[model samples]
Target: MQSPTKPLAYSYIRMSTDIQLKGDSLRRQQQSSKAYADQNGLELAEAFKLEDIGVSAFKGANVSSGALGQFLALIKAGEIARGSYLLVESLDRISRQQVLDSIPVFFDIIKSGINVVTLADKHLYRAGETNFADIMYSVMVLGRAYEESKTKSMRVGAAWENKRKNAGTRKLTKVCPAWLSLQENRTGFDLIPERAEVVRQIFQLADTGNGSFSIARRLNQTAIPTFTKSNGWHESYVTKILNSRAVLGEFQPHRYDDHGDRVPYGEPVADYFPKIIEDDQFHRVQASRRRRLVEGAGRKGPEYRNLFTKIAKCEYCGAPMRFVHKGRPPKGSQALKCTNAVRGLGCESISWRYSDFETSFLYFVKEIDLTATLKAAAERSERATVEQQITVIEEKIRQLTAKRERIFELLTEPGSSTAFIKGKLDECEAAIATEGAQITKLREQRSMADMLPTISADELRSLIASVQDMSAPDIFERRAAVANRLSILVTSLRIAADGRRPKMKGIRTFLESQELNPDERDRLIDHIEKTNKQSQRYNRSFNVMLADGVSRYVVVKSDDPTDIIAEVLVDRDGAISGSDRGMPIGWSDGWDNVFDEPVSV
Candidate 1:
């Protein structure tokens, strides 16, 4: 009645890369599958090892390549063993799609008078016993997971665009020429008080007849270095700084986004960060360009232009005021000011100092009436939003009505043919059908709206402020501020010395007015910290791969990779050295004392 069942079987193994074999990835796994066979009194025979196969799972992980196909082919022909058993080290190691297609294969294997054994999952098959509901549930879960992944991808893309569009004013809090981060929200910048002093000295130098070249030479004589640490400063670099809006006292947002796009610039941060010189010092540089024989042909300003460039309109002309630099001011000094002042567009090139702008900026950044503006914006948003929905419904009705009228006109046209009239009527009929459905949807929306109660002022303000200042936060904070009600306005940039406030526009003015709740901020910080840490590991791993000075190949490390194998190809000049936090916080003591081993790159 039982001739020991002869227990026919085969071994299966896979390794993602050639190097994985050397790491004994397959070798290390075979032993476990073998052990499962030995314990079950089954004999392992032939082996099928698939290497360098490119199909990715990351979903259902309990599949064996060729096993099902071969088994099905054999079973249909009545060729496979009557009581054979299949052996593997568990499912996930074999495939990514664990539950979906695997269970059916398991059913097939059992149908062929076979049972299954797994090493890690400890799965053992008893003939005729299968879990259909569980498998169906798994399918549903996987389906839901896939849907979620798609939704999250779309949401992430949309959020990034939103941040880029609204963050046009983020840079005012960003790193300054002297490395300062002026916003109360930001934690660090390259700014040094001493370096800032040196920049001030540069403006002062240019204010005198010492041209940019002369100023650069004078600067090189001192201990300070340009951003790149060159010995002699260049006129090009000097000109850039004098013309930069940071010196004119404004923070710009949306310098860059997760995906590449030159984000729309932001409004000047209300007087928060300091300016290195007066607006006139910048203007002199501009005038110098115009008065020169070349009409500012070779002149190039700093790359970090403030986001407020076009937002501030010339109040007199009601056109966007342009920032301009002049080399010769009324006082024979360099200055920064609006370009339109003289073009009969507004006023003449008024010379100014980075210092004066910086001082005035401090006041502006500090003085936005956050509460009043936010409340007003909240009201406007509610009104506009509801009205916008109303307009969509009305617009559709009008379109359908227009088509209906056109059909009537076609039927009545003096020489119209019957076929022509019929065609028009058919089109009109189809449009009317679509409009009926749309009208039903709109009625449902309106009914839902009618059922809802209006929010109180405090509640409405809270809702609006929650999404207020979304653009300026860095990668970490920004990711967590996922639910943004962000808005920005770049309406008025430069103001008189005694100007008391920064006029708000868009959503920013509203958020600035509302009182900030620390709890929400902390939640955002936590999410940012977690995600940034993981993303940083990938980035640094990519960098370490660069250090290898080799080609890119798939690599798998066993004992916690010292670094990612792909980063070996990059260099210091490569932008995006890594995630913002390239180096681990506790991995090294400091830049001064770390890496004393004289490592060669």
Candidate 2:
């Protein structure tokens, strides 16, 4: 295969990221080598470009370090080496930087019949050119260039750092994950609601009634995607979420002025931004979390009906009685004794038997015919009145849209005086604003419509039918009913009005129970709203993704909106399907929402 007339070989060009040099200014050298190859009309062979390499000769052609070494390994196997022609961009690009000083070692490269052509010293070398003198001269020049470039790189880096410091740029913009947001400051970040919720969720999970590990396990089970989805989850992420005080939406390291105001840099902002959540709500959720502590610690005694145990008021001190069980003789006996009452307050004969307390409460578990009640509620007369308003809103939105389109026309017309046109523009803008406000008001009404009770009997019947088809487990079904329509009222002793067992005061409504009357509906709504507010005021029901793919939602959980970007999707016929995506703005309007996914008219 060795033809005597054939040209010797080719060369390869490479650039390793030299820490001192700017982006490859080795263009002139590459041009020289190309010129040399072209002038000779040397049948060009292969050219391999080695990039991002730190050292050319020291590190033997390794591509990426991990998981990607297989490709480089194949190249090193030398599957194809019959060619005698090779092209290199420059000599320095091919040779080792440190080996240039060792002239004899540098000359050894041409021994394999591979010529080295470098533009730095403009040396063209074949087997004979690899002598001691040529190697010594070429190495001396290339070494100087390398050291010089490194010096310039150090100077440039220092200048950039120094300029920023002098310009008073102290704060490095921080990418605070959810549970915190950052604002521009000379120093650094301010917490926003987006991140606060994450913080609260973390702490609440740690302090849950079910314990922290159980919370972590549950979170791990859900494939809750974290901020960095590609990296997966970790326990440290979970622990960080729980322990960080950033949940309160306050920078713990920051301080308020003497006037107790947050100087967002210089100006104090009095809750100008949407806060993460209140401290009271977060603390309450944490308090509810049963922590395993040593003996003599305040431990809540189990109650037959402990739902409202320490939370309800006491008769003696007028303060709430702490629920507790004394050991031995009263091991299984659950009692509510007033703490303030013992501290010398009021009536002592206020306690009732735990046996009698929950015995009368068994009616709470009574199952109502959901089909009948929901059917009646959904078909109520009020919904019929509300249905007629949709057409009115549609007509109004159409007119507003037409008016919005005319603003450009009025402003762009020729021969219009500035003052006259300005007035017209202002009038149009005012009208647009009015229309926008009206549209917003209507949209809010539409959203609030779902919050309204199902007064329509027929719709309730439909909902019941749908519910029957839903495969919610027994516990889920019971909780869902409670979430939608149940309320509890607890009081001691029933007041009899005229005769046998007074009809209104003593019992609680719960589980699958419904309002027996219009009055009860109002009462139920009040309690539902009250509980909702309480959940928000005191709970941290946000989630976090740990490094281990575990997801936890802890602290003060409300079933309302979970995140700011959350949406509430509604069909034209007024049934809410739920959120489609987390859109920062409103949902995109399309006819597909109406035609493709039509709701029950």
Candidate 3:
């Protein structure tokens, strides 16, 4: 009862670099903290083993988004006892920031009722103690630490800049892409054949419209060993490989900013690495990825049942039409239904038989000269526009390059501040890099314009003939390939049912305003219900638009399979010539007349 309990103490440890963790920095700090706690008769708490390994104090990263930040937040919230002691190796261990910025942080800890004990100096900064000498001593230590870090940063940056400047003469570092190995002399890199082949295969699969996940799964299923220390391939790694411009034999230099974030430092140097994927093929794969993103078809089933993946939409509500199966295999058929109607969101719930729609589409699509249509759709003016943009970006790059050269010239002048000139050079280089990136994008767009559907009209006709039988084993795969080709040709397929939405909103609002009796309200609701049910049992139609702005309307009657009507809408040139049969009277006026008689929904 006479012996008093020791006050609680927690240790805070941090290291600027991970290399120090491999050394004795961690053990040295831990031992010093434990020894200090023991000699001071304090209970060293094992619950909060705060550490910020490899975090930089120079940029205050350890205090923001690190373990130290979490500890400070807890202290402010009164979770930690007021008189608890915080043991660190030294003042610099807490922060290496400038004295002005770091002093406030040191005082913040002391003011919050925590004692900061520096093990290296054997000094205890007690809570509520405001010694001017102690404050000045801490400031001096922080200032010295900041100067050390700043000097180190400058030296490292200069070394890297030198390496980048001579990248063509020698390899920058031992670290190369997974598919390459740095030579023994460290002068160049050589590609590994097997890994390079795998890289090529990945790009080929992506260009064929396979997503990264699918490619990764395929590789894993085939038991292909990954480049890294992993059991199998991952979608993230596959995406990284696809996105890397390093495969094009170019290298972009980077540098860390004040915030410790890496940013592009200079213009990309071409032929820095061995070219793996061809430029045209790489740009084509990028275009395919962009199309997949816009179409929202990043993931798909192996079957790829629906040709109209993201192209199909409800004409009434503008919601996507989902492909679904109805019933079991022999008796079951695939159908497309409006997404909004399926969710019971006030849209007509008419179902379209996918088999019949596909058949009609294949037959009618043959009437149009696809080759001619595709050629017309490929606008030469668009390529000219991209060329113009590239010219403008090239001009900007020239100006920035000239400015950077002038800055280098000024560095040779007498009494010029080297740091100021270096800063100006960095800004100019960053601007040149940005402009170069814009030029690269414009060139990619130009390449994308050259990418047209690879399938010819005869090949398409033959494919259509081969898949005439719906029950064929490879029918799904064949149709999927056809769908991929059609995705490049067709822009949209808008489906409209024969039914019209009921206009009962005004009546309901008027009834609510009148404070009608329950009986009257029930009677009005019953009338609206009957009207909605009657309107739902009508035919479904689809409006398909080509890339060249040509459209075809197909009306499918559920009650009469033989009553299917396929008619081409008037083209932008006011010419209608897809079907051998002429357009019906009053149809030439437009879609308004086709659904003019609105049925109750």
Candidate 4:
């Protein structure tokens, strides 16, 4: 006859702190469970590995969101076989919750046809067997565990509270930012010069419109070692440094809640660390980041080619116009093509050479009076108006927060409906989120206003002149800097192409009116036909809208790449001016139609 198979037993192990793992906690528990299983003729269920590390059971967190909760759920669903053993080191491993609350969980397991074995005390609560002695023993053990955890939690909380009270005078812990180290006296922090300089360089790069990834790449290329143990710099760490207020010599105290999550507990203390960045520069970097968040952070590459990155759009299908390079110089050239056309989305595939557009735009933009443009923008978005709007939204958020607090108080009242209270809380939270988003948008607007370039008219003109110099060694860098400035000055650039061919009848009439022989007329006719064909290939226009509500309509007539012609039409305060001397006959008509339609910025 075959030997009888042994019963299966699943072991559960838990530790409130991972520090216990460094000692005999894990190994000791494993050995005890193995010994018990071997001695009782039970097979250890290695398949069911249940362990909760760094998980607290004082408030039943282990049973609520940990592996133990999953195991109990499996037992309740009748997945685990009847008469299986759940072996634990002690009752506290299951729960340290108050006896009134923990008794139900303790009894639920036994009632579900599983045996509970406490390896430490060698007690077994078998399935379908209830005894007064077992009940009393479990209650006493659970009660004692709850009291001990409660006392320890209170003591730790009190210690943290005291530390927070003295945070301004002394350092709270040895831990500090990577750029600084706690002093030996334990009263302050000292900055490491090399690391702090790197922090400053990060802020300076950000202020000039470099995003986190760009800054990290630049640092790595220069072989700048990171403050951490990592081999090289990373974008995430760069972003953390950019967003931390610790560089401004401030610290915010935090405390752990009952759920074991850290939350800010008090107002931030000032002058906690050595200041590495000034206030104006810090705010400027923040403003640049916010602007990049809205108007995308443009791509970084060897050549910062696209000046009109997120601002340029195709007038026909409202798709972005991307700058694309076909091949090497002898075979192909860089051009701007509508993304829709490239995707075969029902738009004409007209490629406008970027050289022609850049030259024409810079030549015309130099004629504009930037001082007047800045004044108009200031009038449109007054600082006072933005601040007033921010105040109103903040008040609305405060009222909603108060209302949510009132609803929370009702949760403790007798016979209160939990679902109703939850619904109210959720509604308040949604409203707060909406208002918070509005405030963020308004704040960004104010930041943009603050970040407007503060340079003299001559300096601005010099910058534009430098941007126009394509042969300069640092031309790409110069163009990128000017692009950032233009992003503030210009709101949008709407591009349109006129690919329709010139009328044959009109060409014939014009030729007949001219005094020429048959051969001459034939040659002229052929020339006109060729010009019209070329025009159909590359005749495009742009409607550039300035922040001051001023608009410039630039038409690039690139029938011949070597000798391209451009015309500018300015519309200032409803008055249209600018030379139409060499423009095509009906070019202004297209401009009028575009101006009449609603344009979303």
Reference-based TM-score of each model: 0.22, 0.28, 0.58, 0.62
Q: In candidate 4, list every pair of residues with a backbone clash.
A: none
Of candidate 2, the 10-residue stretch with the lowest lDDT total is 495-504
Identify the runs in model 3 with alpha carbons over 4 angstroms from their true place: 2-5, 73-80, 130-133, 217-232, 252-270, 278-284, 298-305, 309-356, 361-601
Candidate 4 C-alpha lDDT tens digits along 179-293: 9989888888988999999999999888656889989999999999998789888999999999787898878666543345665543456787888998656655665576679
lDDT of 1 at 2: 60
Q: What is the C-alpha lDDT of each candidate?
A: 0.44, 0.40, 0.73, 0.74
Off by over 4 Å in 2: 1-11, 17-86, 95-105, 119-122, 130-133, 152-169, 172-186, 199-601
Put down candidate 2 lDDT per residue, 154-223, tens digits, no spaces: 5653553354344333432353446444565634445544335444565555533334455555556765
Best by TM-score: 4
Residue pairs with clashing backbones, model 3: 532-601
By lDDT rank, best first, the candidates go: 4, 3, 1, 2
TM-score, candidate 3, is 0.58
Instruction: Give the number of colliding residue pairs in candidate 3.
Output: 1
Tens-digit lDDT track of model 1 for 1-601: 8676557666655433244556756765677767767777777765544222332233322133333344556656887566666665654333433345544554566666766656557666544456676445435544554455346545754564455444444432244555464556543233467767777887776544356776787787775666666656788988777656676556544432212234423233434356556654555544443344352232222222222343433322344445454443455433234455546553534333432332222212312233334444444444543434444445545545655665564443223468956776787678767767765765555321222344554554443334333342232122222211111322234332111111212234454456767676556555544443333322211001222232211111223222222121123343222112234222233323321222222
Candidate 3: tens digits of C-alpha lDDT, residues 154-222: 787677767877888898877778999998887788999999999999998886669999999999999
Model 2 residue 175 CA deviation in Å: 7.1
> How far does residue 361 in candidate 3 sit from its true spot (Å)?
5.4
- At residue 442, candidate 1 shows an lDDT of 52
Comparing 3 and 4 on lDDT, the stronger one = 4
